[model samples]
Target chain A: MSWSKAMPANPVVAVAGATGAVGQEFMQVLHDLDFPASEIRALASARSAGKKIEFAGCGQVPAGELIVQEMTPESFKGVDIALFSCGAGISKEMREAVVAAGAVMIDNSSAFRMDEDVPLVVPEVNPDDVSWHSGVIANPNCSTIQMVVALKPLYDIAPIKRVVVSTYQAASGGGAPAMEELYSQTKDFLNGEELKVEVFQHRIAFNCIPHIDVFMDDDSTKEEWKMVVETKKIMGDESIAVAATCVRVPVLRCHAESVNVEFSGEVSVEAAREAYETAEGITVMDDCSSNTYPMPGLLAGTNDTFVGRLRKDPTVEHGLALWVVADQIRKGAALNAVQIAQLLLP
Target chain B: MSWSKAMPANPVVAVAGATGAVGQEFMQVLHDLDFPASEIRALASARSAGKKIEFAGCGQVPAGELIVQEMTPESFKGVDIALFSCGAGISKEMREAVVAAGAVMIDNSSAFRMDEDVPLVVPEVNPDDVSWHSGVIANPNCSTIQMVVALKPLYDIAPIKRVVVSTYQAASGGGAPAMEELYSQTKDFLNGEELKVEVFQHRIAFNCIPHIDVFMDDDSTKEEWKMVVETKKIMGDESIAVAATCVRVPVLRCHAESVNVEFSGEVSVEAAREAYETAEGITVMDDCSSNTYPMPGLLAGTNDTFVGRLRKDPTVEHGLALWVVADQIRKGAALNAVQIAQLLLP
Candidate 1:
């Protein structure tokens, strides 16, 4: 069931849900990567139809204001690639129309992530999974994206048996309104006003919310569950066990994870550092003497996954611990999707 | 080798470092617990001498302002109990003097925590450990105190083989100045002014700092090491393994931990919840249907250690995961030390 389509040297790109946070990031990443898009279109809901989104164009696409058009089934008529940051339902609803028009969709939603027909990809971990996608590719959750990027290089050293991770997730993972809520609530809290907590279950201004997304029957949030199942799917290994606790902190964009990994065989701290140093899309920022490690606030808008605080966990026979941080909207969303698009280029 | 002091029903209590955050909390908790004190003395550095702190009435002590006195070797004379929240150096320097004066020192510093003769205790977990302390009873680190309280009831179900905990610590753990720094820095960050990061290694406003305390030779922070070693000491099981990642979050007071525990035998979520419901000094706040759990911002000033988000981890044969939160100043430090002081009363 291998599927492949010949992508043009410079494809026509459509940025769906162009008014949202990750949607804007998709445009920025395309320009940052100098993606060769012959034409770029901005598509959104009817409410934002006439809005103008400025694009620092890429390749043949001229730098100008892109008029937001109301997205319809026909929006992808000649679009070679559609980058979607729309909600899951919208992504699913437009899936058929997107595929019918012969456009490849790199979706940033959780709609088709676990589907057998769609490839859940982190280019660093499993680029070849793209070869088997029917017409769509799914990006992993923001928290999962950064973690597996850090884990892949180490997994090459030894098969990872288990991972116990606790995340210091940022507000941006909840999208634009969530970020705005954090901003306004923080100002209100400091001003001695009642905090308006609408985007999240609790006041996310200076608090940590252990719940993310929706709760499952098992009481694990869908965000935590996504990390567990998506990692196995992307890593293409059903044997690797992942236990994740996703918590939302007041950080604006970047997410940090304290990950404890157990491997089937011993992997020393020195060996793990050497492996990460040679691995692609990873920067080692670990230096205890200098008091250096990745801080989420300082790492917003970064492309590479930063790994630090590498140490051996003496509790387990073959355990290693590390701190991972990456910009949730960039490497965790838009940048990752665009990277997958580059892989599709002929 | 064992020592016990006969404490009078109404003994004089001296609060060392009375002007600091935990020291002030010690005063509040003494009043909250209705501690019996014939007279209360406020002791601090010479700079703070003559300053007055207001205290509510506690038992035989009347409601009034206590004049601050410069602490010296003679300060402990005729003092039956000395609750110390001073820095480690001062605690170490004054230890022998306080002990020689026949005053039992309940130290809130890390000075003698790991010492062979000092009992590092969380009153809820190891009250009996107080009997072996020759003079000073060490209060466990704020992060460790809350965790051991949550772990104790679970440990009663089955022997915990190992624990992996990640902390979302508040600013208050660093003392009153640190809390003030957070306040000012957060205001600066929101107002677009440059942040002054004097108390912490980095700007902690809307950010998470993975490095807490000093970095050890193993690249693990000393705060992380404290949790590892202190948990084993308080739990009285040298075989139990613990790995901790201590991060300072933006929250002002309470500390929250995402703890993953593996036991020698299976411990179901139902049984864990039941144990927590009946456990002393514990509150069960988990109810996913209502989006209920312990949040640090709302849990400040609360006395009990809260356990929530209880779920079984399918990663290990006998594993359970839970989130624990407690006010760092209350259960973690002041209240625990005050409880230990109560144990000495005849």
Candidate 2:
């Protein structure tokens, strides 16, 4: 069936792993965007199956509640669109069942992202890639998603030669438990009590940990590996060289990145600023004299990618350096997934 | 009088601006390093003159209490060494007095760092640069000091062609008031009160601000400009290109840097690690598999410059990326001054 053809007036949506941090955001985003769905189902593991989540609906959608159900192969029987935020292992196990049930699965996990048939889509950067997906569409990593969104406009002006990114990632990227860990550990530190390290490998209260995810044989963290590969896939440019240093900071929500981009041709700062001002889903917050730049603390819970500190890089022949920030759960994962679901609507 | 001449067993020392943050650290460093001084005088602004500071002296020095004196030209009457951390204006006004009094002024302010006659010294990286000092020696910027110390060993292996650095600086780099502001603002944030941002341009309790120092004409902050020029002067290499993004995080002490270095010749990870391990003031804490990396929280109050997360940068032909952390108060400022004072002894 062609997604472009009108099949139903309103689609039936299923939110897998609905109790998760990103899963909860998925529900909020769908409501905020006023997605026309006749029915919405919240599915999770058996542990959270009976938990109730209230949705303060927006516009025409009436306020309602959902009782989470234990997901099974038969759960997607009449679902037209499924948004999955479970771990990669669960996504791998449940993807085939969702596809067989005739639902277009937009997976936030990395299980099928690198698969030859799967299309990794960032709506603002590569929306066209969504059209070629066979059964599943994948979301890029949170860090890569924001960087690509900010870089897309500039890359369109002049082809990018290479990128060097250093990330100041927040705790929310690891999920709700990680945010709780940061809060508790900080409280303990303030009270002169011993800090317990459970979610992260080290004490993250006022410290910067260079390790994120697990380490690869070559010493690069898996998070850094995802940025290098996912950036190439989402930007649809295999030849663009990328180097990443992903650091975890003691922040709660928004993830910040210092991105240095080198172009094959000359791209002036004025041209770059104009390109960002006209780009979709981007907010330019630069003005060094007035000290108006993006910080994770101020921009948390916002949907737009905030870009600031734009300047010329004197090291390269033609280069520009910028700071980018966005709420990792919203624009990076949930909103992008919902945008893809809106595209698949009849 | 030559500093090399052993005319006296103990030299008269003076601590300028002895009540501020770096000034307090100056006293601690002098005591901890056991600088042999016949007498110690604490000097500060007129408001802080009467305060008493206790020093827990080390080695041959005996513990004693010093009464802070209102600083004047006569404060350096018989002082063989003066550690100045007052602002640039004070340093500029007092330099002639200290020099005429036959005292070498180790100035910590930015007043004389770029002056051609004054040698900008990081003892481990450029000890030879100290030989030609004309009565005044300048300390490099805190952020620049740590990066160069970490890069010095690797640069010696093969000269670094270009450096791209992004810093996670601590609040202590701003001064004692900034540190107090961070603590008070954080307490207010946790208690659901309004955050008062006075010391920094933005809220730095749980955020990162890219603007440090003043903005230059080309939109780069003076802190970033300092890193570029100071790295060249400290390393004695004008051909090396540098780009930096100096950010202030909520950390209380040590500064962390994510540095990517490109070299002119081939350098392997093992070779780079060996150079750091063999360097005078560097500690290699890189064992990614076991999560043994240097973090600012764990390494505060230490003199060594910690280096970790060492790996190859696949974006450059001959390159390496590493993380460096150093106590901004100790090695970054006070300790470097004390080390230079030791070099002046007979």
Writing each residue's lDDT as its tens digit, candidate 2 over A179-230 gives 9998888778887899999999999888889988889989999899999999
Task: Give all candidates' CA lDDT scores.
Answer: 0.93, 0.89
Instruction: Determine the backbone clash count of candidate 1.
Output: 0
The C-alpha local distance difference test score for the whole of candidate 2 amounts to: 0.89
**Candidate 2, residues B209-278: lDDT per residue as tens digits?**
8888999999999999999999999999999899899898878999999999999999899999888777
Question: A1-346, model 1: which lDDT tens digit per residue?
Answer: 5555678999999999999999999999999999999999999999999999999989998899999999999999999999999999999999999988889999999999999889999999999988888899998899999999999998998999999999999999999999999999989988999888798999997799999999998889999999999999988899999999999999999999999999999899999999988999999998888888999999888899999989999999999999999999999999999999999999
Models 1 onward score TM values of 0.99, 0.98
lDDT (tens digit, per residue) of candidate 1 on B138-168: 9999999999999999999999999999999
- Name the lDDT value of residue A21 in candidate 2: 94
Residue B17 of model 1, lDDT score = 94
Docking level of model 1: high
Which window of 10 residues has the lowest lDDT sum in candidate 2 chain B?
B1-10
**What DockQ does model 2 achieve?**
0.84
Model 2, B156: alpha-carbon shift in Å?
Answer: 1.1
Alpha-carbon shift of residue B100 in model 2 (angstroms)? 1.4
Q: Against the true structure, candidate 1 has what lDDT?
A: 0.93
